[model samples]
Target chain A: MPATLRDVAERAQVSIRTVSNVMRGYTHVSDRTRTRVLAAVEELDYRPNPAARTLRTGRTGMLALIVPEIDVPYFSALARDVIAAAAELDFRVMIDQTGHDHERERELLTGDDREMLFDGVLFSPLVTQAELLEMNPSTRIPLVLLGEHDFDDRFDHVAIDNVRAAHDAVRHLLERGRTRIAAIGAQPQEQYATPQQRTAGYELALREAGIEPNPGHTRSAAHYSRADGYAAATELLRLDPRPDAILCFSDLLAMGAMRAVFDAGLTVPDDVAIVGIDDIEEGHYSRPTLTSVSLDTAFIAEHAVARIAARIEEPDLPPEQIVAPHALHVRESSGG
Target chain B: MPATLRDVAERAQVSIRTVSNVMRGYTHVSDRTRTRVLAAVEELDYRPNPAARTLRTGRTGMLALIVPEIDVPYFSALARDVIAAAAELDFRVMIDQTGHDHERERELLTGDDREMLFDGVLFSPLVTQAELLEMNPSTRIPLVLLGEHDFDDRFDHVAIDNVRAAHDAVRHLLERGRTRIAAIGAQPQEQYATPQQRTAGYELALREAGIEPNPGHTRSAAHYSRADGYAAATELLRLDPRPDAILCFSDLLAMGAMRAVFDAGLTVPDDVAIVGIDDIEEGHYSRPTLTSVSLDTAFIAEHAVARIAARIEEPDLPPEQIVAPHALHVRESSGG
Candidate 1:
């Protein structure tokens, strides 16, 4: 059973009016009281009826887009497309970056930001507790989940097949007669979904080809950034038997690995070859054009916007999971 | 002499209470009525007292950072740094992109958005008229103008020295003894300040070096994008006495120019050298690394956030115009 506002106020040790004011995005409430009420909302899993709320207070025609990092090329490109898509629906978007903060993610997902000023939320979270997302669920706040989250079908989700994307990258290297391949971007310590899925695909491809994956060849990156990629590849190149080719989880990491290859006085496709995902624009202009699996961010943005807008109008709509397409382009780096 | 709420109400033919409610961000106001009231506010040049508004209704701890395009590396980097800087001051930032639209720029600069929710705005508009910003001066909304704009001492402005930055880029090419140095990114049609200032600096560098600036050597680009750069360079390479070197206004342009040079069966520096501004991270990892002028975005972001926060405290403080530093980074593209 969902908790009522009175129960939330009791759990927060505040009056019902105080809890209501906090939820309404009023600035009169102190930050401490707001925090307490949000915590209770998270703990008790309180959900306000979307239809009732819409009838009581008119919709703002504003949607909030929350991502982990705005500077990352993938997220920035996705954001531009999402803004354009929402604009077509007569909705304006407000963008915010959590900078991969877990607590901040909790605050925005379950706190006043849910329905305060925005009609719905299009979120690409890195460290979200999926349960907190169900504090209101799919019918609660007109939310759409984006990127790699293990979807439980309680909310609308938009994603790419990360595992298959990784498998295709590794399989392409094998087809090129490159046997000793390595992988970059395995984050085993975190609960992140993208890296784990990519790792599984990489190993699965190698096993199917009758090659036992060497534990030493797989590297973990704390972040899918060029610096991290460079550091990981630098270590990989120093191994007794170096990797002949590498499959990076992201293009930024591939760029770093490419630099590492050049700095070590090796020529691409001769001494080393590389492939990355999310075919960012930088890859096309890089010295040797990068071979990457292009995730259709435009499709993801369009559908995510469409789904959120639909959910706002019909809160009883069943949750959806839309998988965007991905394709690999052969470039100089992979000896295409 | 500023217009009052009553004047705006009279112009829109709406009640004073309705205008007042719109100013307070009430959602009960219909979209059509909201649009009419906002248009009247823009026409009448209504100025609301930000200090009084904060007193009447508690201040929202929100700041807005507006830019031309978030997908552009320069702006995205700036947004990331601005968000970090604002967080340090216990403030949260919401970002929006204009996509270089003139109408949207006018709306955000002088509309109900001014004091509806955000405590202040950090705007980097592409096509803003210098006057609508005066609808309510810097004090009226604690605004900090960023990037290339002609400042008239009516706002707190943070900018890079574009002319000097351009001059440094061109001078580097000349120092390499490349006399036939054609340039790209001259916009003769628009009132945009960056390209115009860059053109001035490029001509000044050639004159100082005792060379006649040939009319054929100047190429205008519709936008500082890779596609535009590639097309412009393709044309420059077809000249009778083709340019032995190129000066691109931006790093993305240089990347495209480099590709054009390669596609024309030539090599960088040994054939046609190139220099670009905005030392983006992509430049560092490109095949033959690009030479560029690095704008200090961190300094701009830090100073802009500090200025806005200070103005929110003392709204009557004197406006400031800060010029962030720039430096030339010589890399492989310029025969470094």
Candidate 2:
């Protein structure tokens, strides 16, 4: 049988409470007593049972990362960074994918399934801010929102400045000597979604460039996917004056747009320049090599982890909203 | 406060034990009593505390999926399928990335960290089967092996038949009238690894086609990544009789190989045919598209979950080895 806390306490010639304090990293323990407890712990190989520790302290050292989807490149990359960052803080992450379903997101928020297993949650909600607000007060675990969400004031949020990043991508395209620029992956019905934020940025950049924003140039997709981008781009290509350049909401969309451009017998950059957001790894090896507005995923992950940890440490602490930095990577597809 | 089990029993007008039996899905309970307890549970919103139940039953209703890396496309895709399968079985999944580190894999195998949190583990070990055997007896939780591992006799395993799948991929390449076929992503140092098994299949197909297997045409990568594949392909292109066709161990490598071919001013299929294993999503959108050996990920996920559940249900049951089906998806890259 494995050694228990009592065995370590007995071996150290200390009380069980004293040993517990040392094991829990309590500063109240004397240095000599701490050293004795540590030595005994090593000698007896007394590793505390995580479940028992969780029961005592109400901290499981586990975080749940609830995202819309895991198979998508962006989410998978973000998850990787989150896991790495959590590991640095000595925490393990449990991943939950909602498949961008509102009901699933609601279930995750309201159900008792994850509350008892994970100490805290890092959620990238697909549900609207209003829905989130309605459910906020009942949340039993500390949560940090990620990606595009308008819950900054109510919850700790870590994300890139989507509007500004999208504006930068459009500005980059405008400066590339392309005037007939089109935007893909717009979700007109959703006011606070990523596509909406990016479209706003696209219009702002066009207006700033003295180019009148054309509603016809803005194409909406049901979701940010390659197939959606391809279909949107195909429609854009059918316009009387085809777009000279296209700025996409995501790398996946951009890749699809590029493919559509090729299928329509056009070359990237020379015929129709392309730029995208989310510098997913596949972009590097893509035919023309994707140029993108790159989110500092590692930076976002670090801050998200730190924020969640702080919230767990101080449950009543005021929520903090952080916008992580992003960069526009000019590559072959963008004529850089 | 949330309703307790005692409160639920009182509301149902049944004994606490009877309520517990109903909640645990025990079949011995009368239908009338079960209905009463369920009604009370719904009215009181008496969601059982998972941790408390775990403590009592020694089942956490959680599974740990320990992979070499979560960010890699193949692993992420597999994880998605696994998560979906686990969800159907009313189990949550905790992801653990070992980063293909032997020490990390060893730690996961020996340490008590996951034992208390997860009921079972689905480990895709980076370590050798010999190392796995050394650590197997000490693992506290039920475990099922995934991906490339030689632990079939001693543990439940779910994977594609790597050798046969690889042979089929090569056979497809040969029948396409390509004579100078090369193989990439061979890890010669690891005798029983996936790359080695695939390479053996590549050789088998070459011999069956009455073509002399050229050792000079076989290139080895330190790891399976686009960059590694690009470097290996660059070397392969320098051979006296450069290969006309390349079969890569992974889609990522094949994507890289395609990039290298373009860089060398060659066109896919017309100049160099490319095929890969693991038909990741990017392959569908990649320029020229990719032809690949596609493992039925959903099938693998289903069997792995079933096997693990069986193992958890009957601890002493003999380990079962299952080889999931795979298909060759012939796309634009292979001249199909």
Clashes found in each candidate (C-alpha, N, C closer than 3 A): 0, 0
| lDDT string, candidate 2, B1-336, tens digits | 667778999999998667755664546678998999999998997756665565446677888999887888888888999999999999889998988678988887666545667778898876777777887453346788888745658777888888898899989989999989999988757744787778888999999999989988889887789998898888888886889999999999999999999999989989899999999978888899999999888988888988888877876678888988999999999997
lDDT of 1 by residue, A217-275 (tens): 99999888999989999999998788999999999999999999999998787888999
Model 2 per-residue lDDT at A40: 99
User: Compared with the true structure, what per-residue lDDT tens digits does model 1 show for residues B91-186?
Assistant: 767677788777777777655323445678898866544554545442245788898757668778899888888888888888899999899999
Q: Any runs in candidate 2 off by more than 4 Å, and if so which? A: A1-48, B1-48
Compared to the true structure, candidate 1 yields what TM-score?
0.79
Clashing pairs in 1: none
Candidate 2: residue A174 Cα off by (Å): 0.9
Q: Can you give the TM-score per candidate against the true fold?
A: 0.79, 0.87
